[model samples]
Target: MTAMPPSSPDEPLQPQRFFAVVPAAGVGKRMGADRPKQYLVLRGRTLIEHTLERLCGFTPIERVIVALAAEDPYREGIAILNSSRVLCCEGGAERCHTVHSALNSLAGIAADSDWVLVHDVARPCVRVEDLQRLLDRLQGHPVGGLLGVPVWDTMKRTASDDQVIGTVDRQHLWRAYTPQMFRYGVLRDALSAVLARGELVTDEAAAIEAAGLKPLLVEGAQDNIKVTRPEDLALAEFYMAQQEAGQS
Candidate 1:
């Protein structure tokens, strides 16, 4: 991991720019789609288009970097991909690798103190207000946080044999969503270290946690769902409709 220089206490803080990174390399095998799930259409636009629109529309996001597969053919046809504010890079086999690739691509452009908001391409229903809230709440925070929702359901611990081992407590538990925000340099170094150790991290927060950092959890709307299975498409569509109608 690359070491970042310590900041002087008397020095004034530098203005930090915000950037968005979308990892869209997954094939979404669980969705059982012929193409990558991001290429699937929702309403009149592709899922990737809607996701990008939301991120690009956010005023604070200076740039949006999309990590795509090397052999991806669908992105070429998307008109929005031609936007100057949006850039693309070759993705890796897993989500963490894809994110790291996007970060590396921004090496010359984004500063270490800048913030990177890592969002999922499948989650098209992320509310604009919720995104603003996240940025607003995390301002001046040393360790950046992520948008998530508290767990409401009864928790359980199960065994490999599909047997219930015991009941678990759900107090203070959260179902993490994205965009998970973190300092560009911190995230890059943490992810690189974790990957180099041959460990798996489900999200940016996990990688930061392994580096002995605790990220704040900002509660967001429950509708910010990642489209994983076939049924989730319909649910996302419904949520998007509600958002468009100004009801969500």
Candidate 2:
């Protein structure tokens, strides 16, 4: 992949459009549901629907791409799948593969310097304000970053035997959140290289880090949570209500 040329200090940077890629291929085994967690209902809508609506609602995001399993039976039923602003592609077995597939799908349409924000479909409480904040802060940054909350709870390290190893320092530690942003070319190259080496990357930030680049950390609301367990669905509903009330 060809890298975008760096802009000189004297030259004004060109404007880059924004795009969103949501990886929704996972079965979410931890949720223990009959179907993927994203296919489950939340406030009368599927989790994937909420996620797609939230991302599509953000005005700055020109397009939203979703990567889904090849045989995902529920996708065609969602009306949003037919929307012009959203596109769907065949996803892989893993999150990294799904993301890479989405990125590849955008190759002809998105410019190398354009920004792509990778978010989780399980995170329905992500606020538009936070999304704007992240884009605002990292617009011209060399390496884009993600929205995260600072760790506030006391932490501990554990041994394989389930014994407490030691009290861990929480200083400078942040709980990573979604909408991790990076340039199209940079992210594609980073993910490609990392996956090629058979490395495991939990998020886009880790992939960027593996490419030897420091991604910026933009502070965001702690309520922007990913729904994993059944209890998390209720909490996400509460947060979503709060966000809606605030918006009203």
lDDT of 2 by residue, 1-248 (tens): 44444588899978779999999999999999999999999999999999999999999999999999988997868999788999999899899999999999999999878999999999998889899999989967877899999999999999999899998899999999999999998999999999999987899999998888888999999888999999999998888888878852
TM-score of each: 0.95, 0.96
Residue 215 C-alpha lDDT in model 1: 87
Candidate 1 Cα RMSD after full superposition onto the native fold (Å): 1.9
Which residue pairs show collisions in model 1? none
lDDT of 2 at 204: 95
Distance from true location, Cα of 9 in model 1, Å: 8.5
What RMSD does model 2 have? 1.8
CA lDDT scores, all candidates in order: 0.91, 0.91
Error of 2 at 132 (Å): 0.5
